[model samples]
Target: MVTPELNGGDVGVGVGGGSFDFQRYLSARADAVNDALDRAMPRGFPERLCESMRYSVLAGGKRVRPVLALAACELVGGDAAAATPVACAVEMIHTMSLIHDDMPCMDDDALRRGRPSNHVAFGEFTALLAGDALHALAFEHVARGCGDHGVPADRTLRAVAELGSASGTGGVAAGQVADKESEGLPVSLAMLEYIHVHKTARLLEAAAVSGAIVGGGADAEVERVRRYARCVGLLFQVVDDVLDMTSTSEQLGKTAGKDVEADKATYPKLLGVDKAREYAADLLAMAEAELDGFDAERAAPLRHLARFIAYRQH
Candidate 1:
């Protein structure tokens, strides 16, 4: 569904036309991202291993990270198509994290994106290996694609480092550790932010920052995009928590209410749904603020994206 602002009567951060066709935009971008991902990975020798990797990577997702990367690139006036390899790299890393996150040792979720979790379908050992392989491939693909596309070596190197940092501690790994520790324990709002910022926000921030860098944005522009992504990243998790509280498995395409069932802390569990929605609204405003100076037409997608995160019913 279209977000509140993009739909019409946009309470704040006015983009009042209600004509962006966001769903169409998302479908087109997702299709291109999926196709690029398909070409980026080929079935190779060690048949089962390749199969495991393909299983998770090909499994459908919202493609948020890759889209963020490409959009940030375009926002900086870079040819979004040239950013394809970096986009694919970000998605590969995200798939890697999901593989590990759903294992028996982690969230142990049986359903992901409407199918059996990777470990359930592929076996833990293979799933584990697949995660490792994808992680490695993310860096390799970034490096290879950067060289082929004639991106400046320095920029390419920075993007590579950025992805590594996002996947490592201080990013996804650190967030996962905090989340696991907080399970079944009382969690403060600050601690929750720490967890989500590190786990979810970090990778998303990296996605936009790296995209901006490779897209040839100035340092100031890249930093601004980072701030915008930080809000969107947290907004994503906040919305997820709300969805778990209100939506069904049929709507979400995955197991619903997993957070509460696990006794894990969530925004709704702490702040209640109304307050959580308020927080999401604040975040949406902040994200939109960061795009203020860019051309409205070029910036419309990012604006629509933030609203989508805020108002998405499904």
Candidate 2:
């Protein structure tokens, strides 16, 4: 769905307008992600490892993280093209996490986004290497992408720092550890908060913040976008928990009901499906509200993106 501004000249097709297809935006974003992926690959990386990275990285999911980054960059008047490398890097990191998370030692699922898990398709050792390779490559892409941008050296350094903290031990890694320990146990809300905030929200916050930095958003704007991102990040997970309870495997492209199977604590389990859905809606609303002072035209995509996160069945 396209988010119409409260008031403005919307020169193009938007959600309900003449020819503005939301799918067009999705297509453009997907193409951008793929192009960035091609640019970010290492020249001499092993052909086999490159093939596996490509296998998952190009596996054709929604490209949500990259979209979020691009949307944030656009909202701040940055060239979406300039943000492509960082977008692709963040997505690579995300995909790598998924690969490792699905290993027998981790979430142990046989399916992902609707196909055999990476570990299932490649041997566990190869999958392990692929995941590790992608992780290192993510940082490499960030450094290279930032360097190519001609951004001020200081700004580039800040961007790299933000990305590092978000994906490193204090962020996604910490969340992963918490998730591993929570299985089959009745998790406290505090622990669940740790998992969602660090594991899920951290990367999202990084995406938005990086977008602003690359776009040269003023300090205030960067902070605002980060706040918006935090709300949406948690909202994303809430919707995920809700979908896990209600969506079918065909819709989700992965094993549904596996949360129950694994006894993983989720919002639906902790707060009930109805309440979780409501919470997701509220968080999205908060995210939109945070953008109230932004240039409405520029922020339209981000607003729509926030709503899309909550409503997306997949």
Candidate 1 regions exceeding 4 Å error are: 1-19
Tens-place lDDT digits, model 2, residues 104-219: 99889899978898888888988999999998888777776676776666776787788889888868988999998989888998899889989998898898888788888899
Candidate 1 on 29-74: residue-level lDDT in tens?
8899999888888587888889889888988788888888888988
Off by over 4 Å in 2: 1-21, 42-45
Clashes of each: 0, 2
What's model 1's lDDT at 227? 95
